[model samples]
Target: MNQFNRQHIGKRIAALRAAHGDSLRQAAARTGVSHTTVGRLEAGQFGTSLNSTLRKIAEGYGVTVEYLLTGRDPQHDFESSLRRLPPEERNRLYFASPVTRIRMLLQFLMAEYPAEFPLDRLAARLGMSPESLRRLVEGCDDRQFTPEEVRRLGEQLAKVTSIPLHWFLSGDSGELAAAIPPEMLGAYVRLIKKAAEAGVRPDLLEMAIDLLILKHREMPAGSQNGRRGG
Candidate 1:
């Protein structure tokens, strides 16, 4: 009913159509909607009141209306069970399997740099052949990269994209990582890692860093020694 729900439903419809190997025209024909209407729906321009239209589109894809609206297959009890777990436990389970990890990483990268990293460009950056990269991106969960290859790719990405190397490696703390520029992310990561290794509490370190920055800012103008009347 809201904008967010409309956009979410539109994206699900588009993804389902793509998965079914249907073009806009084909999907429109199947749903008995005009191609222009199908395009508008896919673009998230459809009003939320079009329940009949939504049902028709869902039927065209041979999927239930629930799946189209929620991006969940109603038949999958395992998925429902996973969502009921605690956040930490859910993340652990999600990333425990190598296939899931690979898929997550690919999805993350695609979402972050959709225009910048096409399959071939991303493959080249990772030092993988185009076909190999395509297979990995296309859900070849069994395809695994060596530790060394991952390290090399991470390092290269850190240098080139200004995204932190740890993001490429661990893929955690995305919001925090995104806030820091690539030029500073390496240093930020090193500082955090060093603090963690030394058993320093993160909150204490954050407070100390904030205070240090404030102190620097409050220093007298043109005072290199940061002392009064120096």
Candidate 2:
């Protein structure tokens, strides 16, 4: 069935804006709608019926109207949203609630099998019926999960997908943070937060900094690696 839900659309709009670091006023400017209208849109204060104004909103968010309305093209839509948001924000959106984690997991699967074949393929991967997956996209929760449920789901998903279980549990990237000494994790994230302000990619920045440390350690003690070029 091809349909949209008011509140679900509103949440996607709001999440996209946050992902883009957009204020309501910025979103309004992009969409050529008033800030108040944009606010109402995020609040899902409209009917599920798609219209011109809604089209403008979708275009402004750099997503197709259909993507917002029907949860199609989730590869482009969800990837852009996740990539544009910083790690901390990504963590919140994915790990905010048990339901959010499930939805995020769905996006992960959709990225693999997006477009025409996603529904049946993804349903198989996640071990759910197609109707069940559709309910999830439509904001219905079959599990009605709590935190404990989220933990168990995270474990199950990690086993199936090989994604780190800690990602679904903790806000930090456990792999990279583990590569760094535990004592330095806080400082590393602080640096990353600062670098993010300057538009440096956090993962890249961490790796580059790690390489520098590795270079220093591999150099002989009191070697010219530490000396200033003359």
Largest lDDT belongs to which candidate?
Answer: 2
Query: Please, what are the lDDT tens digits per residue for candidate 1 over residues 52-169?
Result: 7887886676665656666654224333545677755543442233334444455555555455456776778677798876776676644366667656766754443344455455
106: Cα error in model 2, Å? 1.0
List the lowest-lDDT window of 10 residues for candidate 1.
91-100
Tens digits of per-residue lDDT for model 2, 28-137: 88888778877887787874444777778766766655566655654454456678886656533432554555567676666554653377865675566898778776
Off by over 4 Å in 1: 78-230
lDDT of the structure predicted as candidate 2: 0.64
- Candidate 2 clashes between residue pairs 3 or more apart in a chain or in different chains: none
Per-model TM-score on C-alpha atoms:
0.32, 0.32
